[model samples]
Target: MNRITITILVLSAAATACGTSRSATGGAREGSGTVTGIITLADEVSPKTGDFCSGLNVRVTPTGAPEDVLGNGTVRTSRSRCSYQIANLPSGGESLAFSVKLPAAWQCGNGATPTVTPEPQTLQLRDYQTETRDFRVSCTAPSAETSTATP
Candidate 1:
């Protein structure tokens, strides 16, 4: 019981079994993985807006975060509708790219028939798999222009 306290108790049980033998997957490792999605609004009328976007802003650039923000970077929705979501992320195994900005003059039609004709536009998403990927966005505005008005 004295060899330097049994070699410091066998190096503290081998450093707690190498920190619990690693294995969480979602934390991505064995080939790495992660990516979740949801950003809607591919109809009505929308195309020329800013303020970081009104109803959707799912940004991600993984592969070891090629410039900060690799998970839950941006995600917002309202401006009447058009879903939005971006969680966890960090799996850029397929060179990702997703962009949807609409809220300036904001018009995706069908808000009650604002010249209804599938007006809104501006929806792009690549690689896919932000959990499942279900994006849509269209641009257009007017009719008292509202959608949070702006910043």
Candidate 2:
């Protein structure tokens, strides 16, 4: 092959190694960025799941993405801690929708309940970066339980 042709082939192969490149085998470095956040309630309630936050689930979807992209970023409460993280997200400026799920055991009590209305939040994320946002729910202890608290 001519020198020009060989040089072009080499450049093409090199460019394909970048993060944004997609290989013929459907291999690409996707989701090099991360998105993280916490879930909290106005009132403290007993964690139904061991040390972890109970009656909670988190779902994150790419903003303006197609419906077929379901289940891209999804997590359920199980371990200790109320925070969650979605890693390996594609780089560049992207948006996400954060939402939660609560079980029946999470009492509404006398205080406000977790904010699930006003629409779930949409967060913008970039590659090789982490976005931290918290979601507050209006949850309160039972009236009797709260009243009986030690002084």
Highest lDDT model number? 2
RMSD of each: 13.7, 9.7
Q: Write the per-residue lDDT of candidate 1 for residues 1-151, one digit (tens) a residue.
A: 6998989999999999887764332344222333444444454545534433453445545334434434444454446344445554434354444444444465545554224223323222334433445555543443575487566
lDDT of each: 0.46, 0.57
What is the TM-score (0 to 1) of candidate 2?
0.52
User: Residue 137 of model 2: what lDDT?
Assistant: 62
Worst ten-residue run, lDDT, model 2?
66-75
For candidate 2, the lDDT comes to 0.57
lDDT of 2 by residue, 11-101 (tens): 9888886756553223343556666776665445444455445445665556664332322353446333476666665565566565667
Off by over 4 Å in 2: 1-29, 44-55, 65-81, 111-113, 116-120, 139-151
User: Using TM-score as the measure, which candidate wins?
Assistant: 2
Alpha carbon deviation, residue 131, candidate 1 (Å)? 3.0
